[model samples]
Every structure is written in C-alpha cells, then in structure tokens.
Target: MAGTATHHGIPLRSGSGLSYRFDPGALGFELLPTGGPDWMARYEVLHTPEDLRRWVGQSRLDPTPEPEIGAEDVPAARALRDALWRIGLARVAGEGPADADLATLNAAAARPPLVPVIGQDGAAGWAAPATGAQVLSTVARDAIAVLTGPYADRIRICSGDNCALMYVDTSRPGRRRWCAMENCGNRHKVRAHRARQSGE
Candidate 1:
C-alpha cells in the first residue's frame, strides 16, 4: 500500500514563496532534505525531539510510528540522513557507496524496525510507543531495499540548476526529469521563454 505508492507527498516551500509537494520516491531519500553533514548543516531542520516527531508524521510511513524521539535521536537521524545522501549520490554517479556509509546504514538496519499490526478496523497500524531506533531502522531497511532493487539504477539528481534533490525515476519510460514538473520543470520553461523574448 503506502510503501508501494508511486509517490510520497512532502510539502516544501521555495525561496520564491512557491509551495509544492516533492516526491523523493522512497522513505530513505526523504530524509536527505532534513539536513546532512558538513556544508549541508545550514539546511538543518531536525533541531528537537518534536522536530523529529513532526517529520515522522509528515513522512510516508503508513500509520506513522510515533517514536519516542529523544535529544540523542536528533544527531543519530542527521548522521543516518547524511550517510544516505552520500550513498544516493554515489549510486547516481555509478560508483559504489562508501564503506563508512554502508556501515552506518547496516548498523541502523540491524535494529528492529517499527512493528506493524492490523487494527480492529482492519486498518494498518504500528505498535504503540515505538523507539527512535526503530524509526531509523525502518528507514535504513527501506534504503537497503531500494539500493538493491531494480530501480536502483534509476536514482537521479534533479536536472534543475542549483537543485540537488535526489529521486528515483520510476516512470515506465524512465524519462521523468526534475524534482517536480511544477517546480523545476516550470522554472526551466519560464527561463527558456525569457531567453527567447530577449533574443527577439
């Protein structure tokens, strides 16, 4: 169901005040925009336990796991997300993921993931009061699946200039480009129009 859905809607706002939904196409790649290591620290959004909780709610995790996020979970999430960023980029470049990053993912995946159960209403649900570790574990496991799955070769960096968002191109023709057509794709169209007008 949720996991098998073609896209997960992540609400985002652009510098120009445009709001749009970004579908990174997988649970793990969704973590990358929260922040990363080194220069990416500027984009840091996982500031508090609540912040992490909020993100989990916003994430594609079906029947979202209400993990008891702690202060320590914050840094751990950032670390995992940064590692994922490196791994994703490496895949895009046709290079192997680094050992260190692989180790990080493996360690997280070793932990028990969020427990799922069917509710009385037959709706999907997660075991109550999950741990932060479980949340990370779930994300790591998802990453592992995508990395080793058929679409692994379809991972791509957005073609928009100055945009570094990564997404798995799951289109049947595999010709999908841009993070979102309404966002980067439309921007490219506008730029081309302006250039044409200038040349006239």
Candidate 2:
C-alpha cells in the first residue's frame, strides 16, 4: 500500500527513505537479455549496483541465470548490462505538461490494429516474430504507467544540479529540494556553501 512502484524494472518510490522490492513483470522480459539497444537500456535500469542490492537482487535477474547466448557478434553482454543501467539511472522526468509525457508513452504503447505477421519477408526461413516484441512493448507501457500515474504532480526530476534523476516530492508544501536528500541535495548544499565563503 505504501511501497514504491516498479517502472520497467526500475523501482520508483513514493516517500523518501522508503525501501524497494523487485518484480520481473516490471522488467518486461521473459527470459533474460542478449544485446542490442533495447536489451541494453533495460538491463542498465535493472542492474545497477545499489539498485541490484536493493530491488533487482530480490528479483530473478540478479545473477543472470545463463541464457544460451554465444553470439559474440551481438552486443557485449557484460558491458550492455552496465551501460543500460547507467542510462536508465539518468531517468529524470520533466514537468510542465505531465500529460505530454503520459501521452507520448501511451502513444508508443497504443495497441496497433491486430494484424498477423506473415513472416519477415515471405521467405519464412528467418522472419522475426512480433509476438515477443509486442508483449515486451506492452510491459514497457505498463512501466510508464507506474511512474506517472497516481502522483504525477509530485513526481519530479532533480533541479538541484546537472543530475536528472526522478524523485517524488514529499515535502510539506510539495516543494521537494533534490532528487534525493543524500545525493544531489547534499551536493547542492556544499556548492552553495563554497560560493558563499568565496563571496564573503
């Protein structure tokens, strides 16, 4: 009732200092991951060190149960994992018209007219199936719903520094200071202090 929601495998919290848990349903993946941008980006969000220890560790993807992927031509497995999480770590939602973000995500996830995939190019030898991709897309849309729904107004990206991490503002007046009081909040405070000292 009072826990954070998992967004595309990333844990989005409601209140500060509140802990997180894991859910593979949030990851949008059935097996694990290979390479490529899609897999890489998703991997990044789900496998960060601290995040792994917190949420992902509890999930099924923590140790990577060795999916049969021997394709060296594919993206680097180890690097893809790290890269994806780093990029996702930079998830900072913007304000102004919240509906815009919501709308965009919704549109991307909007159900397309149901049509049968007739094989990649009629060759039938190796036609990429849309079933898996389609399901994954749907899961991604659900992830966005997790981030923006319920408390769209209170959700915000940190404006304290160059960082862009998303955080829910839980201050009394709804004017939260930073992405996290321990990270950007403290950094901004230190910068302000040095500026004042030099000025004085």
Candidate 3:
C-alpha cells in the first residue's frame, strides 16, 4: 500500500462456509479523477486497529499495537488474504501439486529488500541477493508459491457474522471462528439465539 503502484480489478472475495459479494465502493474504495476500470480507485476504507485486533483474537501470534491501522494495511488483512486463498487453491489444483504457498510467504517476508546480483563476463543478470520482490515478476511467482505452500492448513476464513475477511489461524487445532472474536462471532451467536426465539 505504500508503493506508488496500484493493482487493477477487484480482488476476488471468497469464504469457506459462505460468500458475500459487494462492490469495492461498499467498503469505501473511491474512484479517482483519472479514468480506470470499475474497481480501480483511491480507497477511504481500511481496517482499523480495532478491526484487526478483533480479527486475530486469542491466536498464537501476539496482537499488534492499537493504533490507527492504515488504508494500506487493509488489503493485507482482507483482500490479500482472499487473494492468497485463490492463489493457493489454483496452485494446489494444478498438476503435480505441492503446498508451498506458506513457504513462499515465509520466505518472501523473511527477506530484506532486493540488492543487485552481478554476473560474470560483465553481464548483469538481475538477482536479488534476498527473497524480496524484483523488478520482474519473480515476485509474483514467489507470491503464488507462498499462498499454496505447505502450511495450507493454517489458512482459514472466519465464521463470524457476514464478514468477508480471511486469516491464518495458527491455533493448536487450527480451528478458528469469527472475523473478530468479541464482535463478529458474538453477533452471530446472538443472532442465532434471537432467530431461534422468533423461528426464522
């Protein structure tokens, strides 16, 4: 999100038990002055720190600070997660499948920025000394790998309310519910109880 670059098209929204579809504008992504595709826009929407805090719940990973989470971080928590899900599914569904998506994410995240790799014979073959994104699309290749990597079990969508966010549940049983524990899950539970009372 910090980069000058922007991605085109809507990031596909997916879920395990159910799916919800809404335009990007519904989540507050706004159109820019320049002409572009329907989903292209500047965004007013993002996850608040509270949103994320509720999302992770009592997971093994410790909570991040309670600051104003940025517009940039939004994709990581929501769209990026869904994107990873798609990428993982596609890669796994391919021939000779192996789950290396988690590895891809770990390896990529483990890296620093790209430095140059010099070749012999005075020809420069651009290789980043590390696993980070390059000027070319090797970054995308790695990204695909990360999403479909061996840790596929950890990736899960929330069972809370009608939320459309997904997350990596690093729990012991690998079972997680709700996009946020205190709110989304609770709301769903309450709704269920009320429905039983009224017989929906």
The candidate scoring highest on lDDT is 1
TM-score of each: 0.92, 0.37, 0.35
lDDT scores of the candidates, listed in order: 0.84, 0.37, 0.36
lDDT of 1 by residue, 1-200 (tens): 43222345777776688998888888888888787877778888999999888888777876344678899988889889999999998888889989999999999999998888776676676788788888899999999999999999999999998888888888899997899888999999999999999999
lDDT of 2: 0.37
The candidate, 2 or 3, that scores higher on lDDT is 2
What range of 10 consecutive residues in model 1 has the weakest lDDT sum? 1-10
Q: Candidate 3 residues 1-200, lDDT tens each?
A: 11111222222223343332212211111111111122423222334644443332222111222223344444444443333444434443453333454443344445342233334554333333321122112233334443455545454445655543444454566566654444466567888899999995
Tell me the RMSD of model 3 versus the true structure: 14.4
Model 3, residue 139: displacement in angstroms? 12
Backbone clashes, each candidate = 0, 3, 10
Error of 1 at 196 (Å): 3.8
Candidate 2: clashing pairs of residues: 44-84, 44-85, 45-85
Better of 1 and 3 by lDDT: 1
